[model samples]
Target: MENQVFESSEERTFQYQSSLPSLPVPALDESLKKYLDAVKPFLNHKEYQRTEDIVKKFEHGIGKVLHHKLLERAKVKKNWLEEWWLNVAYLDARIPTQIYYNFGGPGPYLEHYWPPKEGTQIERGCIAIWHTLKYWELIRTEKVIVHRYGNMPLDMSQFRMIFCTCKIPGIPRDSLSNYFRTESEGECPSHLIVLCRGRVFAFDAVHEGHILSPPEIFRQLAYIQKRCHNEPDGPGLAALTSGERTQWAEIREYLTNLDPKNLSLLEKIQSSLFVISLDDSSPNGTPEDYTPITKLSLTGDPTIRWGDKSYNCIIFSNGTFGSNCDTFVADLSPCKRLLGQDLTLI
Candidate 1:
């Protein structure tokens, strides 16, 4: 077997640099004012003052750093600061103005906070905000808006919103609480709208029939790890344990002999392999239900051959559907060799 290689620091830097495009002066429009008004109430809410202050402070510091970097990049040209202002205006028009925190339950309970329920498209606003914040340096802003809404079925008593000295719109009056429903799936149409440079964008807490969050993904990962431990002769394991033997002991022994870093690689490969098999056997032929599986492989150098024909392997990732024959056909190549057979026999 050949050793797997990782990219070098210079290679990684080059890749990162290649992905970024040259900064362009984006247009500012009246829609930005509308977006600001839409998100004002949440930003100015008393509950979120502290968080808002902190974020503003961070943004200010980051903006200063970016200004210096950009100035140097442009050879200290006059009016270079104007470029930064344009970037900031562009971002302000797109990003949200508040961040909502969950306030449900007695002790330490927090729910998923989405956007406002009415008068705006929440998903679009959220994505715009995300993009602005992510590219803040390139698109500078003194203050950024982040609309926060509590998760459904969860109480909003502890919910908090953070913002600067911005006023929220009152005309399209609506509460963040009223937008989302407690349904198990589908988009909430009445969610808050995000206006960016006069263009409207929307976002929904519901994605692919479920809500998105970091904790949810972490829980799923833990479940998969536990299942892997309990099942003796599991997909990757070649043996089983009895009453006198503990599975943990076998795992420990295996770890001792293998490189620690390879463990992650092995897990990734094993998880992907499992998804491929599971998808192939599914009655509905869809992998959306398998959220824990991240990647799948259908064909590779490791081919399985039967008689005169060779079958290629298939691969997939989470959020991917096996029914998409176009993706499979486009990604995979035909296998020309056979497994458990002599190459000359073909």
Candidate 2:
């Protein structure tokens, strides 16, 4: 597929959002049949027969009531699976999300013009962050090209969660928070969060109505790196995010109640554009051998990566890159495509 940005006023990217089809609810009997078929291989003949009878009973009883309610839900909601999927598959899951749910990959630029280079971490990171911010601008202006299948448009709603979005944990469930706004909608937060040496810092991505250039970003990153090198390590509060869901939720509530300034700091990190993880591990690997980088992307430095953020760009010490992305909010392929195209600019 090719991408072509829309410059016309009438041809906006999300123009077809209302016309897209709503999520369909499967028939209860058909769903039960498939479930029985899936379980048959694991059960003996008698067990299978007993399971089939149970399934048949349920299909005609309370299952019918639940399916009717689901159908009623589909009539009112465009995508009935949207919130339910987030809550059930992600938020309510008690496992460590960073290792189990998040997606990670080695940067494609290593095989291209930008290979691993020593002492280039801050420099390359600034360039990548600048391009990422540009992509954010495209989304804000609704100028990014929309994906389509034949004549039908696919969902573009995930793009809004690509930046300034986070998942807030609850006692037994979690909820997603998105602070992104299109240019037509109004002003949105333009700050960025930097994670280095177990510390967190925030700065504005836009100043004087213009996004910061790579050089300006470079200076900011340099200062952060310098301070990290000179000072003692921070408390590394980001590490708490890697724990079990309910436990983290309780801790988060306690943390917010500890001090009001702490709550503001947490919100600032939650609503920023995305996270930039300046890591110390330099996993030397090539495009053909990505095992080392991939391992680190998923398992390295939990203190430097926010496990719940929608996107985390991990810049290694040797200037190679890896991405740790939350798969619940959106697919990683779109961001990869955008970053791949932007890498060509450098």
Candidate 3:
């Protein structure tokens, strides 16, 4: 089948959003039946019968009321699961978002380009960043082709949160913050945060309409690297972000009350486009290097990571890179695919 092209802004990407199917609410009896089946393995027949009886009562009574409420919610909101899922699966939970919610993986470029030389990191970072920014521009202009199943265009909402996004911790609950803006919409944040040895720095990555040249970016990175080398190790305060969210919230509040400047700094971290981690150790491996992804992205140096950022790129001293994505569902490879080797299908 020939691919459909959407040129007009409103007619493109999210044009079908209103027509998309609304999220479904499962039937009470059906869900109760599945619940019983799932718990059956852990119970004897008598116990199972007792459990079944309770479920039957609840299904016809309170469960029916709740299910009706859910269906009404589905009618009001096309994607009812978004908030509930995020709360239950992520925000409301106290577990750290690192390994529990986020996943890590290495770049596949090593398969074709091996033997990491000293200068290659800058070259590769330039290529990667340039491609990344271009992808964002496409999304901003509504030019990135939409993905569809049969005739329905899959939702492109999540793509916006991939950049210029971070999670903000609050009392009892945490919230997500997204600052992205299309060129037509408004100005987007064009600065990137660099985290090294628990310290952080920010620099403008965009020069005019283009991303900073490799030489410029390298110079900035080199400057930060030298400063870190000469100075005593930083407090690695970023690690607190990787700890339990509510605990982090308390620490964050203390820091805020401790000083106005500290509150401003926290706001800066939350508002930045994304974070770059200048890691201390280097782990060598093949193109499919899952080890470094684990070490660098999740368990390595917590000091160098901004755990709440939507995307955290960890660049090792050896020039390898791994991504620790705050949101587990996002796949950054599409940014590569939109710029790299042609894709098979949308």
Candidate 4:
């Protein structure tokens, strides 16, 4: 018989897609199962399904809520998982344990969120504006002071310090180690010192500091919340405490309309100070050999450090830092002269 090509009907027309394999459901603990059973009427099978199926369902539901424009914009052309991989990489560098929160004041009262046991001491870079001004004397004396405020403080003193203990890579060794190992000023690590109210200060393990003033930090936080639409309680719950909610709401509303350009200016200054090490060396004499310790975004800000001096270099969307790259270049150009060398503009 002559050789002949053959096609099946199945190949010509697509059949209904096969259902994905049913994921195994873990056996719930007795207490959890009982509780789930009690609430079965309200949640139906969706709440008591296999974890994999539940995750898929949740993803599908979220897809429905996303705006079509946003979905289109977020879609990856290639290597779609790159963002997830990057997120994983970032999370891996974070400290596994939580730090104790101590509100600054006469009483070293611990906050509700303080971990039961101190895990590894993580370095939180830089001192806040308020800490520099309000607690400068105390920080200088004690080397460590607990912040009464929660999270980052709001203040204007953009002076920031880099320390050795943070979970993040590339930070210098602990200040205590530098202090004990070397008395020579040359051996001393470049310190991020805040000079406020005629006082100089640094944060120790027990104390904390921020890069912004209280009002400024608050404004930034408000701006972030407004942009992200975050809420302390789950979304759509308006029954929470009115006083506190109203206060934050007002701040958030005000900041929503405010220009972010000025805020970016302060962040740039502080970020720059964080990466520079005064103790490091520059070919010109002033330390110009500083490498950026933090990964900076072209759209956001870049933290650059040389020796003991660091600064946040802001890059505009156009790949220019600020009005013009030359503007910043001109400002930093003088530092080369401080290195005892005359250099021509690039």
Top-TM-score candidate index:
2
- lDDT ranking from best candidate downward: 2, 3, 1, 4
Per residue, candidate 1 scores C-alpha lDDT tens digits across 1-346 of 2222332333221223233333432222233335445666777566456555654565468745665576476564434454455334321222221111101111000112421123122222223333322222111121112212332121111111111011111122211111111122222221111111111112222234333343432333233333433643222221111111233234534763576554543222221101111121111122233222111222211111000001111211111222111010110111211001111100
Q: Candidate 1 at residue 2, lDDT? A: 21
Give each model's whole-structure lDDT: 0.24, 0.83, 0.72, 0.24
- lDDT, candidate 2, 141-185, per-residue tens: 898878777766788888899999988878778778889999898
Cα error of candidate 1 at position 210, Å = 42
Clashing pairs in 2: none
Clashes of each: 36, 0, 0, 33
Candidate 1 versus the native: TM-score? Answer: 0.21
- For candidate 4, lDDT tens digit of each residue in 172-285? 110111121112212222223221111112221121232344554333323322332342212211111111323423443343347565233222222221221111111111
Report lDDT (Cα) of residue 245, candidate 4: 25
> Sorted by TM-score, highest first, which candidate order results?
2, 3, 1, 4
The sequence of per-residue lDDT tens digits that candidate 3 reaches over residues 1-346 is 3245444454555456677788788878788889998999999999999999999899889888898889989988988888888877778878887657776767533645644445455456655666666666677677867777776678777777878888877768888878887666788877777787667776767765677666667766777777777877778878888888888999888888887878877766777767778776766756555675566667788888878888887776666677787873371242321121110110
Per-candidate TM equals 0.21, 0.88, 0.84, 0.20
